[model samples]
Target: MDMRALRYFVEVVRQNGFRRASATLHVTQPAISRAIGQLEEEFELNFLVREPRGVCLTPEGDVLYRRASLILQQADSLASELRDLRSMVSGTLRVGLPPMTGSTFFGDVITEFRRQYPGVQLQIIEYGSNQFAGALSDGHVEIAAAMLPIEGEGFLTQTFARERLALLCSRDHRLAARKKVTLRELSDETFVAFTSDFKVNNLIDRLCNQEGFEPSVSGRSSHLDLLVSMVTSGMGVALLPVTVCRGIRSSRLRVVTVIDPVISFDQALVRHRDTYLSRSARAWIEIASEVLGFHVDPVFVA
Candidate 1:
């Protein structure tokens, strides 16, 4: 059948009458009726049932309507995809970034990317490590940066950097006098922690569990900066990634390396293996690797 006839049939089905479809299509009612008649003749089946109140689709018409709707929708999407391909670097790139580690590379990479692709728009969504992976899996973001140890089927993970997890405390705290400490040494100390939702918090819990004790969490905050501030104020001690601790060189806070059973976390770039990366997304990933001085491999380690 002609595409035009199919379009007319769809309009008539939508409007529920030839008169309404003709008015909407700017054609005479006879023309709309004739188009529907021609479609039915070509298909060799009755497509619509006439009623005094309105028109109703026959069984075959219902099937054809469903297929026609899908075809039209795909046609529109194809047009959009063609336009995007013609100007590959001029669309929005939606990125999901975990806190702290994301900021480490954002400034340099974003600056360089903008300089390279002036037409591209970058949209960054900040999520905690625990939520970043989920955002990517659920298709809420096109790309994500998260802490390592993420495992699932059908995901592509790239390790970008390795950072130590350090013990942070107020300068006046007793542990500050020591050059280094072990996880067992902090058994009795009160700690400041991120919320239960954070991956870092889970790591801490796992370490504490391995030490045969639960952490004495005195305070909890979602923001890493605020957590550091609380540690500096002597509110409580906290274990923070070296990246974050290094970023904030507070005189009131002192950082010590954990010697025994040392723990490290990897920063990763993750995306779906099956999905195609847009030009902007791929460019941003490349910029990230260059700024960090490391080529990220698609792998995760516990």
Candidate 2:
């Protein structure tokens, strides 16, 4: 019934405990407990089943949790939308980016955005594809840059850039001398892949499947530089964006393009379809388009 109670309930469910949720919300555990107890009493239903480790949600609580999450998301957007009524293009603009995005032209885009909208507080978050998609969908961030074909609905995308994934191998590898290589050729070699949370893994899996072999992964990492380092140390070969590969100055590394079904890495700036675009958000998108040189219409895909 109460917004604060609902938020407390949601955080408890998210953190799977009372103490952690209280810590996260900067409130006392008794406050959260009282809030949840009040919600249950108000609805005349048992919402949670207490456990030693944490707590489990009753069926009623599960249903309320789903609905309350959406309600809170909308409430957050409503406040932001109200703030957008101000004359100045000033407010907090939160944008999510993949960790590897900086190796591309996005740094320049951020610089230009700050130059134009100095009054706006720009909060940049670096998260992998899955994490940021959740952040964007939950209204925690206004816009995000991610690999194209973002899953789920209620989101729209504007194209950023498209480039092939280049193979990075140590100079001692037999394929290092080639300008281009196919996925089939690298089947026998050890692979260094991004962590499972990245959507890039989906592309890698599909390409590897089409090539009739699974990648023999030697290591996994979330950092691009670490992956490149692993390849440099001869730990394994890696597939990286060509834009990122351009910045690698190691002589021991060879950047070769993949072909015979080239693995394309297409990136786009994504935002919720119905979200109110603040002036700051709009300016960031426009600057990204200008920097990336893509003037196309917003792609209505997920």
Candidate 3:
């Protein structure tokens, strides 16, 4: 019936009892009960049913709680936007980056952002694709450039670029001089891959298996430089995004195309779906899109 009542109801449902909810909301138990009672009276619907340990939501209560929570979040987001507009800009924008993605893809964007928003602190963290979702959700980073397709209920993603993955080998290796190679062609070769948690690691393995044999993964590292360095050392062949490979200035490492089935990783900028984007973060996103020539629409999760 009222925002206060809705807040009271949601808190009660969250804290599981009137006493705890009142304590959490800094309101009295009677006020909480009175608010819940008023909601029931107004809707003529039983919202909560008693449970042994606490209270459980009735079907109606569950539905109302969901809507009320979303409404409250929207209200808070509106306030944040207004507050940012009124204040002189400056806040930390923690950016999550898959190892080496920043330098290859968003390097110019980051520099341009610094020139425009000198007051904003841009903290760059080198993380792998494996931790993109968790890092965003946990507020470890406000924005991230990750290898897609990254799907999670808590994220909103905008595809910036789709880069091809190629076979990288030491110049001395047997396949190093080839123009292009297929997944099956490299099936038996010992492989240097990103750590097992990375999406690229799984993708390489999956494509290899689809070609009928599992890849022989010999070693793993989370760093792009390390992977190529290992390959140059003749440890094994590696698969890496072309953009990343281009940045590796090494005569000993050869970056060749993947034919047969040209595999690629989609690079996207990911943000937490439910968090309010400060003006600073939004500006960074726009700059990234402009610099990368990526046309994207806001894709949100439920």
Candidate 3 regions exceeding 4 Å error are: 1-85, 296-302
lDDT of 2 by residue, 1-302 (tens): 79999999988987789999999789999999999999999989998888999989999989998888788878877877788786668888988988876547688998998899998999887788877667776676888988888888888888778867889999999998899887898889899989997888898889898889988998999998899889999999998888888988988999998988888977888888877777788888778778888885745331
Whose TM-score is higher: candidate 2's or candidate 3's?
Answer: 2
Query: Could you give candidate 1's per-residue lDDT for residues 141-168 as a string of tens digits?
Result: 6688887777676778887788788899
Report residue 265 deviation for candidate 2 (angstroms): 3.4
lDDT for 243 in candidate 3 is 78
> Positional deviation of 17 in candidate 2, in angstroms?
6.5
Clashing pairs in 3: none
User: Comparing candidate 1 with candidate 2, which one achieves the higher lDDT?
Assistant: 2
Q: In candidate 3, what are the lDDT values of residues 23-114, reduced to their tens digit?
A: 86799998888888998999999999978789999889889987887776566556657868887667677888877566887779889999
Global Cα RMSD, each model: 13.0, 3.2, 9.3
lDDT ranking, best first: 2, 3, 1
RMSD of 1: 13.0
